[model samples]
Target: MASTDAPPLDANRYRQDFPILSSVLHGDQPLVYLDNAATTQRPRCVIEKIVEVYERQYANVHRGIHWLSDQSTDLFEEAREKTRRFINAPLREEVIFTTGATGAINLVARSWGDANLQAGDEILVTEMEHHSNLVPWHQLAERSGCRVKFIPITDEGRLDLEQLPALLTEKTKLVAFTAVSNVLGTINPVVEIVEQAHQAGALALVDAAQSAPHGRNDVQAWNADFVAFSGHKMLAPSGVGILYGRASLLDAMPPFLGGGSMIHRVTMDGFEPAELPAKFEAGTPPIVSAIGLGAAIDYLEDIGVDNIHHYAQMLTQQAHDVLEEVGGVRFFGPPPAEKAGIVSFTLEGIHAHDVAQILDQYGVAIRAGHHCAMPLHKRLGVAASNRASFYFYNTPEEIDALADGLRAAKRVFRR
Candidate 1:
């Protein structure tokens, strides 16, 4: 039997690292933050890293020979190395910086998809995809004359893996899916999906925006051809994200944007693009946020990713068990064993936004509405749902508070 015991963690100690967690809201009630899936609060270390870069070493990277520029450039490249190590990418140059996961997906769609996909080629995605993952492919298909298809999810909110074999075929050029669903909390079987995609001669691109924070996104283990995730989703600042592509494949693709440092030489007519990562990262990159992301990576490593994953799983199971006992709660996705530390559900008669607003009165914060997964919400037969997502810094007490808040919302709505 699988172990039910959760690994021990000093969540209070971890909570102290995030200064914003100390804030009291809605009168004197302590804040109960359950929205880490949107963006995690930054720790002191990550905040300090951002401040350090701006206060001490801020400069445009890659062009200047002065000391400040040299220092800033070194730190910027070091962050790339940090990201490469964070996701276990095979090579440092394989990690390309972008605006966010949305930008990263667009990069892959425009550069690789445009170059490789033919008129009749098909790109396979999941119905559970966030708009970031789905829209880019749709746009790509519209431009390149390729078809976009979806892998259906079961009633339980898990991908119907039995259909994978039939869905994957010679005409399928790529299979783009999320490693974890932002709405359903479903953790897809990445290794199985990647292997199947490869067997069918299709590349795999994993949208790891949700899973990256929980720390199980190992590109080497999954053998994914491309992966995209946001640093902000993993406790760093916003406006920075990563795209990890196989070095050889990245080298072969055309550049997504043309400008500045991404080029080797600029003629009056055409310019030759730079190599590997720089080829994709055009203009001035998000230097300060990248450095902060590096610090965030360092902070997570110090806590041990495996430990965080276990604690988050425990929290998910605890919340799931408690919410299941609530009278009107209807949960989405598989059980905690197959999901991340996320619980999306609906209360019997209350609207999702109203539930969230009531929870806010109790100082509990959660996400509501389509959560950028309108297709998945449509599949689940609901226009919106309430989502309480957890992280290592979250506590059982907060989950309890969430349950209390839910009951309170129900009582208010029942009146």
Candidate 2:
């Protein structure tokens, strides 16, 4: 259900802000870009913000007494504050800037996992997790001799939550899972899972790469130990992401990377790590990209994330209806009402790559693969599928265009 508060989303009006949405592909065809689950197109505002930083205020953040450095440092920290507010994180110090969600998860797996986890400890992730969420845990397990267990997904592409009770025991040190499946579009109940993890004495980490751009993620309400999301997936530039850790937990964990800006003092004996955020940040952070993320957050808040969520769901429902009429289509995951704006499907007698090629000729761009969830593909008994993921800027017309493109692909393959 849509949140009751926000005003209705005017997708058409907002589309103008995203300059790339008006591009002409294949020389003549209007571009219908729907690969949002991978990464979203940035608005003009975010783009300009990046340029502004580089042009006027480009300097390495922290420890510089000069004006340029001070300007850059302020912008960088201000971005962190913006991220904290956006996710409703309890403190600005809790927010750390990293390369992307992968970096964030690895930070946790290395720092916290090394300090807290030991041999025989368990980490529970779901079968539907993107590789970024799964691989780190596997690596951590390999390093710490901790066991990695998966929460199985139903045939309907949802986590079989009933098994959680059995899986989450005292031995489980962490429960790391995706907020939404990149391929399946299944929106896992973050709050419910986090609560269960807590009850079992395991800290919960949310991979919000798929969910953050579409809706509000109140970290406080979820009460998760850590939350990670990429700026690129939410209409900002790449090379920047947020990691929100609980204040108490962050205070206890060791630094993941040690270098310049991360140490308070250096000596012949040893070095003391800097405070929260900086301790994990290490080296020069993505100064411009982080500022761009702040601008993107501003743009989202102005339009209201709730409105974006409702609009994307509506577009997703429309996609499901239109694709059904295209014939020879098999959809994955739950119905659109129960999921995000991602629809993964396969066509009869046509390979996913072939379908994707035909769609591209029509200037319709969609992802066609396991979408970094190879294990999920193995579970679903398919090699890969064509995915059309929507965002707030997507329209009903675009969904219809996707259907028409699919029909074209079918006719071509039949020939």
**What is candidate 2's lDDT per residue for 1-415, written digit by digit as tens?**
2234443677788899999999999799999999999999999999999999999999989978999999999998888889999999988999999999999999999999989888999999999999999999999988999999999999999999999999988899999999999999999999999999999999999999999998889999999999999999999899999899998999899888989988999999999998877898888888899999999999999999988888888888888888888989999999898788899999988989999999999999999988999999999999989999999888778899999999999899883
Candidate 1 lDDT over residue span 1-415, tens digit each: 1345645688999999999999999679899999999989999999988888899999999989899999999999998998898898889989999999999999999999989987999999999999999999999989999999999999999999899999998999999999999988999999999999999999999999999998568899999999999999899999999999999999999999988889998899999999878899899999899988899999999998888888888888888888877778999999888878889999989999999999999899999999999999999999999999999999889999999999999889882
**By TM-score, how accurate is candidate 2?**
0.97
Please state the error at residue 92 of candidate 2 in Å.
0.4
Off by over 4 Å in 2: 1-7
Candidate 1 local Cα displacement, residue 216, angstroms? 2.4
Number of colliding residue pairs in model 1: 0
